[model samples]
Target chain A: MTAELPLQDASLVQWKPNRDRAKLIQMIVKVISGGFAAVSILTTIGIIGTLIIETAAFFSEVPIWNFLTDAKWTPLFSTQQFGIFVLISATVMIAFLSILVALPLGLLSAICLSEYASPKIRQILKPILEVLAGVPTVVYGFFALLTVTPVLQFIIEQLQIILPFIPDLKIFNALSAALVMGIMITPMVASLSEDAIYAVPQRLRDGAYALGATKRETVTAVVLPASLSGIVASIILAISRAVGETMIVSLAAGANPVLGFNPFNSVMTMTAFIANTVKGEAPHGTTAYFTLYAVGTTLFLMTLALNIFSFWFVRRFREKYD
Target chain B: MDVNEPTGGLEQSPEFVQDLEGRYRLDAIFEFATWAATAIAIGVLAWLLISVLIDGLGTLDWQFITSFPSRKAERAGILPALQGTILLMVVVATFSFPLGVGAAIYLEEFATDNWFTRVVEILIGNLAGVPSIIYGLLGLTVFLRLFSDITQGPTILSGGLTLTLLILPVVIVATRESLRAVPDSTRLAGFALGANRWQVVWSHVLPAAMPGVMTGMILALSRAIGDTATLLVTGAAAFIPFSPDGFLSRYTALPIQIYNWASRPQAEFHNLAASGIIVLMAVLLIMNTTAVVLRNKFQQRS
Candidate 1:
């Protein structure tokens, strides 16, 4: 028994070292993963730092006031003007127009999918709708340029005969770009809004029904109100996407930067300007090169504001049914 | 009032009956309107697909897939662009999968509740909302300028790195969701057997979460494959007559080539663009289908 006890003690001593090694390995794994996690934070810093550095360089050469207030945006021409409003106005116009097309359609689709569609129908239809979202924006740009633009031109031509006041649609018009962009974002809006609507407790709907409310009345008066924050957040996010959308506007919306709100006119958006500028060579340290960062900074700030607002709105207004 | 009557005296009033009928009719109309909205959305998708097919299907031949860009639209092929896209996907997958999964594992399995973890969570959410194009600018300054020696200038490596950053947030979010779905009981069981944290995660939790992680990875890669603006900003060449041979080789992707072709005024170029769309969509469809299948299979398992 004494000899057996010595052997057991020896085995226990051996196991202790192996366990300690395992503990060390686990600690190393955690540290490595924490390093990987830090990469995301580093990436955020890189984006902001890069934008700020280049933007500061650009602002040094071009006054901040001129960059903000100038009406002309001919950075490529010999006579360069840096009034950013030209691009901003066009960006806002297209974004607003796209939302006009997307919101009602998206909201209605959400209402139908959540309130009316059966589980089976939802299983089929939801993926089909998401397919729209999955299609690349470049493809949407192609469709806008070739299919939607021509269709709009024909419609405008026909309208001209009756309305007489209707202007001829340009080959590269904001209307085609906005319409296509809207279509591209519809699935996003629908999916998010549907999730929000679906999150509304069934008991709420039952309560509305008990009060003699019709299905339409229940959706509008109860479900939509309950999910209002989510719906609005979705819309704001969609708007942010539209503002930053590049390919659709660059290819279909044209490169002419004009400070106006005419969807019929060919207008260059801030994103389009950035895309077009980068496509051509702009030497390093040149103002033209820096404009990319300048415009990019503006874009980042705008989208960031919208994103932060949406996040805040969600946290503020979320209904805790439990 | 008769006890057996379907409607009582109050309900049988003409105005009351009329109002009920009106309400029902409005409900039906509203339902139809919602259906109409959905149909319009679907109709646009169908139209986009059909139109591209009609224009591109004729142009989509073996010769078209094998050839390089040419002055004549009919002679142009997508071989280089296709190769670049595939290689880019490989590079992106190689980097983003490990990094994103590690971050997610750290957040879900290892990290204690702290300010640093909270800050990382918020940053990732914000990063996801940041536009894809902004990542391009980051790549331009960071990869193209700062790390130009390592990346070479405007090479497939740089573009791939940029895309990896762009999709990392998506991968982390997806992975975290999957990891969260894993029950704590599984971890407890592993611990009960004297397994360490790394062993538990590597041997038990990861395998359990693999289906979802795979689905997420495929989706993220698919998004990278379709991306154009980021690559454009990262300097994917407009005309790469030769296929990329290495990471340092200048490259053009399918979407970038499609954009270049679509922007050309000639009708033939538009046809080429449509064909490229077909190829791109086909890839996406395959990826999305795989994701769905993986998710469904695993769902059935657990």
Candidate 2:
């Protein structure tokens, strides 16, 4: 309201003719943006809604008992088996195998990055790890099929001579897919756990050192314990990633719907099953079409559980270092 | 921590010396283990890059990049897939960038911290984590049912819309982060000077946050380019012999084409898949480098 005001448009008078118009603009912008934010919420609802509708159609024909109980998954055959457990077991087998490979390596690297490396070293190293995650799942799938499997088979061949009890490994087997998946997911685990580990209070480490504990002892006993929730969340996130992994397993795991846990055998995961179903032109409303949604619903629930729990841990139990 | 360490070395008792030896050994082993893990990860990356380049290098001719699919693997090329990929990126960017940025701006600047804000935050977080394949299903069911007349069923528009939905959370989250980085004092200063919320955000905050938002958008589009599963479910054809003529025309992307080619039993197709991969990675590298440079420039400025 004064001539000395710093703003360019300022005047001695408070009369700006379009000020009311600006107020109207503000309301429109806010309301319109509120609608835009709702789109994401709508997307989640659409996913669940579509899956539930189609899954219901699927259940009407096959009966829920058959889906929940049957042990075979040959939907294309005249016999028509729809065993979801077979798909789940294979999915779990790969997820378990990948987690086994990823968890220790990822956690250790995270510890190293946070505890041992300087800022300069971490700057160089963290980007290199991110590059691994940046590579597409499609490329990783190609790598598994082309490079990892042959390498795995060669190793198994060598190992077979020393340990004859090792079964004959198929070219397209769970081991190769799991190995590549673990590599693919390592960055996810490491970056996330690094945040958790880095958040641990420095005073805690100083206290451990004061007690004459070694660096190893301090990291394991003090930092890891303090950041346990975050570490577990990272693992859960990695597991979800592995479970939702489609291309790697689809390309390398050889889509045989088997129920056993042999890593050397060819098996189909739930994601692979959904993808394989879509490769063909299944007519709408057919058993084949409905199968995609049912399988998708199952996969959705699995990843949703993992994500929900991980998010809960991160929000609820993260150690704040002030 | 070392700065905070005690001034003198530990007392020179025999027990202390013994403990020091044990601690030193353990420290060496821990260091070795962590280094070895990093080494293994780096080694795998090196091997993957080398192998893809080696397999693809011989086939990287102008003819291979610009021709259509052929029965003979030697004659087949990635023209349609590449074109489709570019077209889809354009479509997805056009749809998602504005929508995502708007959402982010609204959430960060306009919404008061309340239950609605909290729900929106949690919902977006969950969306960010959903698998790509599920989005494919959503596209198939929702777009096919509602927007087929507009999107032209199973075409590039449909596939592009699928990716748009899939990457929305990624963009929103990125924009929100960059928007958050624009210090609140700037917004307060604008408000104190009588600018409205929209004018303050538009003229001040977004301009400052442009580089970050642009980087996020480009990276998200690059990610959409390599997606195979969602588009496959959205009915991106495995073999679109012709380049996409429009958003409604038949289309296939580099990743889907590579998946198709690689899955074939023939050895030659596998090599073509590798070459396609090299092209895809090159596209991504260019985009990624641009983002990195933009971010570096922004970093230098601030």
Candidate 3:
């Protein structure tokens, strides 16, 4: 055993010192990189913890029942009422209207790009769509408030003469914001849906063509159904984005938190409420201040649910043609 | 070409001819509708750009670029906001790029198949989908309040840190994708050369993935530059008459300045807002173009 130990020591002595140094450096790199990876996990914890702690503080002052069931939201005023539904209704309306605009346009654009457009045309159109996607939401806010709102008001005025039932469009109405937000999200929907459509195998298309199906019929029937999960996932993601959208709504959708369904009315969305209120000097620990976190918790939960469902739906229902 | 003709030796019924014509008509209509949808989408973008350019070009003189925000519309400029935005980009890039790239390298190159690694990957994906505003809430609580002693309230440092967290997931994902694209043959070759794992990654793998890493970094920075909500929630000042002198100094960004100006009731301020948008869009265009160019160059080389 002693002779074997000496032989092992002799082998160890032959090992270069630089190799140990290299190994030490590698270990340090691994530790550093691992720490960096942990930051994201820590950040998630930070976001959830921050929301919970502040939301708990908010609920301590105002009963959860008042927050949920109240008809009014006037936390900024002396006569404070906390009606979460008032903000949620407006948020949902805008998101719904925005989706109404985005779905048809986005899906059609995806169909055009994926199934119809030549490769050259696809190359040209894709970047144009990307440019649309890349525009800042704050810029969309500017466009909505300044340009789209005026045009919408003019159209509403002309429509009033014929229909007579249309309400007067407020200068700051939900329709204008919804329309612009729809435009903002259209590119995302188009791109994601295009990916889904493109993933539908060529054999499927060939099979449909062999069976005498026209391009439109095949797309509507076969391709769309085959890629339904991905398309739905994209739509859900867009909805989540619209729900979380802040700048456009805050700038265009007015600051009145009313519980109603009229798209023509000036309304406040959840994100807009948080944004506008934070702009004011609501000192820390105040009920008004805590309201931001409470509202944020609601927004976070909503988007989280949507995001989770989107990914889940994609995994659950993804059609494996292979 | 006549629908009534039995060209293929099969008898053509009148109903069949009519149905074929109807299908062709429907196909043409659907085609036109798709084109129209694409047109409308592009048209909105064109209109936005044209209107902003028409209103902003006259205001985007050298004087406007150099001067600071003022109460008077005639003399007001975006110098402070522009500087703050540039500075904030620097801070965000410096911090997020290294951390994101490192995390990506760990996950892609070093991590073994384990529950912790799986959880980290999943968490990163979900974090990317979280709203920018929630990150703002996080910044308000953690950086502005919890770390107030270090951050000195809502300064550029706090805002930059908030944005860093917001975009880290994007960067990590992008970097991981690029690293994954680097063929395993490269690593194998390095290993065959008796190089250690870190040496192989540092010398060979990382250089190959640098182009994509840079593209992702630029895109993340562009997102950070245009982000107003997070900064607003982090208490970025509306009227910073002076430029941000340091990381801890109070600051305002281009988007925040634009929001402030656009929200006003005055037409002159709206014009100023358009000019700010012009500047902001210009910056974004340059970054995006550079990213595209880099990606194309790398793709061609490979």
Q: Pick the candidate with the highest lDDT.
A: 3
For residues A1-322, could you state the per-residue lDDT of candidate 3 as single tens digits? 3456653687777866488889999999999999999999999999999999999999999999999999998999999999999999999999999999999999999999998899999999999999999899999999999999999999989999999998999989999999999999999899999999999999998999898899888989899999999999999999999999999999999999999889999999999998999999689978999999999999999999999999999999999986
lDDT of 2 by residue, A184-272 (tens): 99999999999989988889999999987888989888989999999999999999989988999999998899988999999999999
Q: For model 2, what is the error of residue B187's alpha carbon versus the real structure, in angstroms, after optimal superposition?
A: 1.2
The order of the candidates by TM-score, greatest first, is: 1, 3, 2
User: What lDDT score goes with residue B99 in model 3?
Assistant: 97
The list of candidate 2 runs beyond 4 A from truth reads A1-15, B1-18
Q: Candidate 2: lDDT of A203?
A: 90
TM-score versus the correct structure, for each prediction: 0.95, 0.95, 0.95
| Cα distance off (Å), candidate 1, residue A81 | 1.0
lDDT of each: 0.93, 0.90, 0.94
Model 3, position B5: C-alpha lDDT score: 62
Error of 3 at A263 (Å): 0.8
Answer with 1 or 2, whichever has the higher TM-score. Answer: 1
**What is the full ranking by lDDT, best candidate first?**
3, 1, 2
lDDT of 1 by residue, A173-249 (tens): 99999999999889989999999999999999999999888889999999999999999999999999999899999
Candidate 1 per-residue lDDT over residues B9-98, each given as its tens digit: 657876665478888899899999999999999999999999999999999999989999888998999999999999999999999999
DockQ for all models:
0.83, 0.72, 0.80
Interface RMSD of each: 0.7, 0.9, 0.6
Model 1's DockQ score = 0.83
Error of 1 at B139 (Å): 0.4
